[model samples]
Target: MMNCQFVFLLLVIYMLYLFVGAAIFSVLEQPYEEQLREKVLNMWDDFLEIHPCLSEEKLEDFLRTALLVKSFGVSVLRNISGFEVKWDFVSSLFFAGTTLTTIGYGHPFPISLSGKVFCVFYCLIGIPFTLSLLSIVAQKLTIFLRDRPLHYFHHRWNTSNNKLEWIHAIVVISILCLFSFFIPAIFFNFLEENWGYADALYFCFISLSTVGLGDYVPGERSGQRLPALYKLLVVGYLLLGLVCVFLMVEIFKNLLKHNQILSLFLLGYEAGRQDEEIDHVSTNDSEVPFAPRNDETTRRRVTHSASPNEKSYGSISPSRAPAIIT
Candidate 1:
């Protein structure tokens, strides 16, 4: 129950964080977006003025063809306005977050030497911080599911421990898939004009996995103005999607822990146990006396025994064996 509350609180804080970032990004990027739009319009007007003999319809067709050719790398005309936007505070913040999370969408990047240097240092600190934050969230989410939801299912079904564990894993995975991928994909398909259901689903999968192929970013589509509300919603979706993905991974790890066949694929299990045993033996050997070897030359033998209260080391000598026993 406490874990559930902690997850809830963390989610609330994360949503607020997304909203703050979205607000700042929208504010900083809006001017550049408008400037890019104006520049495109001015370029079109200049082209029309230069070619007065060309009809409006013909000019439109030519411009569309040019854009298509440019998109396909069949033309020399580069989209200069696209690269004119500065990496302002909000853009830098969002990029840094994405970088730390390993979701390099590649829509924006550092072009300057100083920015690249800063990026290197920023990631050194930020990646670990992001990973630790994700780990904590995943842990709390696991505890929450186990204590509240799984506990209820266990009692209600009167199931065995193994079955209950599997049931818990299934329930958590179903919820995560529904919220993180299916539902969000539906929303992304609706919001993104060019995206189909499959494309949206792929985007969600890639983004959650931090593969971030950059082919289908949420915003920044051409000729589309992202409203502040939509931007906030997208940011919220990203945060919640990441949480669900981490939660699913945590539940899957727990399931693997209970499955002998599957657990073998996990590396270093026995090696880790052996390392722990070596440490324990070393610590014990420091406090205990060495036992004598069993050899014909040494008529005395030593045996070591340990109990809850104390440990005893006894030596048996052939000459004094009777007295030693007493």
Candidate 2:
């Protein structure tokens, strides 16, 4: 019952967060949306006046068709933006990547029946593959990046696990913010036309989070130089960025598992026990290539177990082993 309550509490918080986001976006964007609507209406009226032969209903139908094409990422405007092909090799690769990552940016979607059917099957297979890939990459990265290095320092410097965890959290957050967001945002701010630093930062955060709002996709403007290269780079960024996110999440989860008191408070007793069980499997999983317990760690544990401090400082309790969610 306590676990259920905790879960429900988390759900409520999540719903509240979503509602807050909806309210904020509505407040920010609705006025601009209304203004754009009125502007479009005025433009239509003026166009009808200038082109006296065109009927309002006919123009409306034409406008709808044009919008439909635009939604599929094809521009039909009168040579305002040059003909940018949506189905090129690079574009298809980017689309495929986004699909596998489950980003699902709203534009350039399939309108045809066959293409849509293919997309359904593609996602069915691809999303799992992408997830597995992310898991594998994260595991490999954590061994080199988090597990071994932290263990080495813990033994060599005689650092406590709690200190190491705090350091890991702060360092990882800073590094990810720098590489995954800040640096890329700087590049995007310069590269994207009419985009300010905030817009670029928003795009980076949204893309990395897999929100893919489609409000401000990079390299979508008119006559952009090296468009294919830019798109391919974006795909690469998504792949690496996702891996970084996965690694960061795994680290924080480990932090939580190691801090049993915090876990009990946050997850409740039943859920924390379940999490502990999962952590045992995670320890087993590490036996393959990048297990948290490297040979050095094992030797250190062996040496430390003979000491008087084994229970107090050397070995972590079975209940508090670092966990992965698999």
Candidate 3:
């Protein structure tokens, strides 16, 4: 009976996913990005008006938007979960690639109440799985990044010592930090007049971290239309940035376990101790020969035992007397 009930619940969820999820997936497409933003913003405003405790200024409007977008975006990914792309194997690969990166960009979303619930549930479960999966993929990508021509400078200049791993890690991280955090931020500051560099940095960090605080997004400058190509590019960049961070963390972990520095320190200390012991042994060699000493009583006992054990003491008394006389 319990099994039947479980199966029934699952069936309902599956059906809910099919119709409602498809609706949300379709509605969440790039065409609706602005609309969703506006709706969420208006809702946010109303929320603050109702509860003055919810301060709008402190929260910052941009961060609010990023959160909403991320929430909706995650919902969209969850809604479309398990839907396979069929536009040939190649196109399908592209679709799968985009979905995992959270770049749904309107290709999919959720509709009905059940679907929305499912989406929320799915994301709750799926996001971690998605992250783990992406991490594996990023590890593979890191190998390629490390082999790039410029990496040679990092690898060669760093010493043969264990600290070299950290040096290499720092180099890789510097490249990622500059491109993902600094470069985008600089561009944003130029494009959006009056926006502070801090805000730009904040935006870059939020986006790259996938926190999508929305408080400071790019292309939100005055009179700017959110360009489709730009949005797509931003999504891709964020994904790559995250991958870079993961790779850096992984490399750092590997360096810690490398054991080169620790082993060298331990072995070097041990060798020094051994050398001192050897020197002491050489000095002592002239003072005494290495041999055991026996007392006179022990030596006497050995000599007596070797003398053929006169009369083999355990015989009868009469036999013993006869031997003595002989």
Candidate 4:
């Protein structure tokens, strides 16, 4: 019952956050967007005025067609040499990888009927595969980045579990953030001439978070060298970054467990059985049947457990073998 109430509160908070973000973005961006819209309208009127013999309907159709072409990732920026080839083999390969990864910069999407249909089917199958891949990697990295170091520190330093967990969280978050976000942003800053460090950092955050706002995509600049290679690198970075994010999320959940209020988000539930797979080392106390340390509730819970022959998730078989369980 308490968990349900907590979940409800979190939902309310989330909705509030969304509305606040919407209001803030509107305030920040709306005026500029309106100004741009007016400027474009004026440009259209001026162009029509300069070419009075041109039919207004024809001009409107042409404008719409140009916009549609750009929307479909076709470069409508024509010069004497013709528009850039955006759908060539390398570009298409990059587009396919981005689509599969769900980074989807929104610059190069399928325009054709068959291509769009294929895209829908491709994503239907591929997104799950991508997520599964990330999960698998996160599990492995959890062992390397989280488990081994934490185990060593706790055992060697004789540190308390609470302090060790906090240290673990801080260390893991720092190292992963450096590699996944900060380092990538540095590279992006150097590679993308128009991007400032802040812009590059924003791009890294947006891409790795899979928000893909498309406002700050790299390798899209005209005269960009080795655009295909750059896109492939971005896709690779996204996969590694996602794995780090997954590991960070586990740390986030672990830290949340320490906080009585925030712990409700987990609702004392995990996706799968926690007891069966892991053994020997300290497990989440949340998995324990009830509080066992000296207290009225603990005493009652112990009596209840003994009466019911309750099984604890901890490794040891239960008959009040707390040390063995840990």
The 10 consecutive residues of candidate 4 with the worst lDDT sum are 268-277
Measured with C-alpha atoms, the lDDT of residue 76 in candidate 3 is 22
lDDT of 4 at 280: 26
How far does residue 284 in candidate 4 sit from its true spot (Å)? Answer: 26
Q: Judging by lDDT against the true structure, name the best candidate.
A: 2
Query: Ranking by TM-score, best first?
Result: 2, 4, 1, 3
Q: In angstroms, how far off is 235's CA in candidate 1?
A: 3.3
Error of 1 at 280 (Å): 6.5
lDDT of 2 at 298: 48
**Model 3 Cα lDDT, one tens digit per residue, 282-310:** 57753442222243333333332344434
State each model's CA lDDT, in order: 0.71, 0.82, 0.59, 0.77
Q: Candidate 4 lDDT, tens digit per residue, 204-235?
A: 88887878888986777777777777877877
**lDDT of model number 1:** 0.71
lDDT of 2 at 265: 63
Task: List where candidate 4 sits over 4 angstroms from the true fold.
Answer: 1-4, 49-55, 80-83, 266-326
- RMSD, one per candidate, in order: 15.0, 12.8, 21.0, 9.9
CA displacement after TM-score superposition, residue 325 of candidate 3 (Å): 41
Across residues 165-282, which tens digit of lDDT does each residue of candidate 2 receive? Answer: 7897789868977899989989999889799999999998898898998898877888888989999999999899899889888887778877777676664756766887899976
The lDDT, on a scale of 0 to 1, for candidate 2 is: 0.82
TM-score of each: 0.61, 0.77, 0.41, 0.75
